[model samples]
Target: MTQSADEGFTTRQVHAGSDARAARPRALPIYMTAGFPFDGFDDAAAHFDQGDGFGYTRTGNPTVDAVERKIASLEGGAQALLVASGQAAVTVVLLGLVSAGEHIVCATHIYEGTRGLILDNLARLNIEVDFVDDVNDVAEWESKIRPTTRVLFAESIANARNDLLDIASIARVADGHGIPLVVDNTFATPYLLRPIEHGAAIVVHSASKFLAGQGSVLGGVIIDDGRFDAVRSGALYPHLTGTGRLGGSSLAERHGGLARIAYLRETVAPRLGPTPSPLNAFLVGQGLETLSLRVQRQSENALIVAEWLSTRPEVASVDYVGLPSHPHHALAGRYLARGNGSVFTFTLRGGIDEARSFVEALRVITHMTHLGDVRSLILHPGTTSHVRRTPEEREAHGVLPGTLRLSIGIEDSADLIADLSRGLDASHPPLETVEAVREESGALDVVVAA
Candidate 1:
């Protein structure tokens, strides 16, 4: 129905990118073509020079573009770009805007994989990243900002851990400095939280996760808010400021509102070489058809599971925005429309070893590194995802050795809770030993006590 112009999210999800015909297929057709056929020699030149409307798979694919357009409409973005993975989206976005000398102010609560990409992989490229606690007073973010600071990056719902960002407040801080606020909305997804509506300048997603609704595909999407003025800040973005080095012309000149995403597709995609496979894009497209339903079901199951975990004697604390006790509970209610999300973290009565044991003991929940799967999955961030970090670094981001990140699935809540209870029974350490350790530490004020 051509983006609906005015329709509910479910309606938009079903009809946004489809054109019904007299012979409408029940399922979305997979374009699955590597290159588009050109009209003529002049048409080929025009297509290559213009660099839009799909030339090659590396440049553009119809299936990927269809998904990108659908996501853009869903997230209220002017335009969007689909990439191989969420990490690629961030890399292209950063490289598109910031040069080697530039710096980024990122939240400490970011996903461990993203943290590694920014600090480890990107560091070798001369990119500097400064991480601040998402809950730190707003002044901390401002204090970290420097003359070379180019982007303010955060996660709408901090991955694994459920520390939620004050998006509007952060957006205001970013606006006062004339910077763009980039939010990784993977965990929240657009169904639960639309960051653009809250002043985020750009929204990125690991479409491999909840957006795909299953673990069958790997995809990423970057959606542009179209609010940043490239002309004014073009110096920080060379591909935007300079005469087109990658392509004939810079995206800033060709597509003003979509400058960043366009540049990412045409200029950076060729160099970064992180385009999603047509097969993966097709799977994600199928997942998008039922995104709302899966997200809602997952969220509801998560809330019940979080509550059950909190009541368990073997559980210490829960890190879910849905719970009233969480620090970001109120903010979550305001931002997340559907629910707080299926991925949440909790601590076992014991420490890291016990957390690992619990994961091993689980009967129903799969022990895996990935989240947002159709089947319930459990992970120990300290050992699995954040194993690269030292104990000090891990604690700085609120990941305790005993912390267990649970990605509650669409399974019945009762079955999920029973499965967790089995793990909890297996994981809790001796009560006397725990008490002795607490006494020896001589400080009960630690955030990890739970």
Candidate 2:
């Protein structure tokens, strides 16, 4: 009983691949085997020579395949591939698209981990990556394009700040240049916004985050919308377009619109060894079963907390798009139809010293570097995520010395606000500092009298 395409998101997330087995179990069974036995002689020959079935777990697995199908269905993608972690997904996806000497245009407002990957790791491969200052400006995205550029990548909702990218407008820019638009949908998840439906050619997610719900096991997913014409743009994507390395058919001809994902599945992921363990896949599947319920409640809680923080004297500004005070709230309205997402940044009134006090004073919210968890998380971006970035560069991306990023979770709104208020009260300078300054002034007057 394959799920109907007309099924709602909530329905699809839970029931998409539930009935694939002959006898359905209450929970999806994990095929925990590393290798499946071959039928012998001719069967093994067919499997090895023709790429017929799953001979090795590294190439594919039943548990991973089922989870991939559910994610693809949720994102309205032609196909999906699950990887070991979010970094692995981004690495394999970019490697599958661009070889050395090619270039990529990226948006500046992205996760700091990804920024490091693009700036340091990819640069080592000689694959140039240029970042656009204003991702909202189509012109800025276009201006970064070169003859060798192959992909335009941005986040659907940035992790550091809840920045919204104009997916359709940027997708149009990539279309004009005959390249694919790769969007990181890790923060928004599919419940909030599906980037592929808005004209993005490919969508990626760090399933370890909200998709995992509890931050249990690490996972990543790549969804191909199957719209990019890799075959048509042979000159730009010769690797995907040229004759197959094994001498049969090119990836472009074999998979058509989904050549990029096929290239990853067959070539990149296998060799890179980013295979997801069946147990991890099962954990992530468990998270997906309740994605809508968790994400919806999390968004509501985030909005309530963001609004309350904005009114406090200890807060200077908030970066959540749900707040009208945000500079990109209108863009949020146009793109984020469901909710603006739960992760955002806020600036403490004092500098790094205040941020330290606030983090130390936190009782309910955890002060960890992770986000999109079941428990609320807080971190000072300047000292943590964006620490590698120079002070000027960090400031350019709104990571001020006083700025703190929050990933609101499914906690009670009142509890979260109360905890934040406690942090605020502790963030201000201690009364002893004022008295110490006055005592120093009195000493100077006594010296003059002497």
Best by TM-score: 2
After superposing all C-alphas onto the true structure, candidate 2 shows an RMSD in angstroms of 8.9
lDDT by residue (tens digit), candidate 1, 1-450: 378567799988876876545565666667676777776788888887666466788788877878888899889888888899988888888777777878999998887778888888778889898988754359999999998888899998886568888899898888777778899999988888888998988999999998897898888889989865776767766666567544555567777767777777766877779979988988988888888898899999999999988988777789898999988888877888678899999987668788877888888899887788888888888877888889998877667878988898899888888888777666775678778888868666564676
- Itemize residue pairs with steric clashes in candidate 2: none
Clashes in candidate 1: how many?
Answer: 0
Q: What local lDDT score does residue 446 receive in model 2, on the 0 to 100 scale?
A: 100
**CA RMSD, predictions in order:** 10.9, 8.9
Q: List, residue by residue over 1-450, the lDDT tens digit for candidate 2.
A: 478889899989987875455777788889887887777788889987667887888998888998999999999999999999999999899989888988999998888778888878889999898988888899989989999999999998875667788899999999888998999999899999998898999899999999989978899999998765764677887878889656878887777877778888888999999999999999999999999999999999989998998998788889889999887899888887778889999998879999998999999999997888999999888988889889998888888989998989988899999999889878875579768979999999999999
Question: Using lDDT as the measure, which candidate wins?
Answer: 2
TM-score for predicted model 2 compared with the true structure? 0.90
Q: Whole-model lDDT for model 2 versus the true structure?
A: 0.88
Measured with C-alpha atoms, the lDDT of residue 177 in candidate 1 is 74
Lowest lDDT sum, 10 consecutive residues, model 1, at 241-250
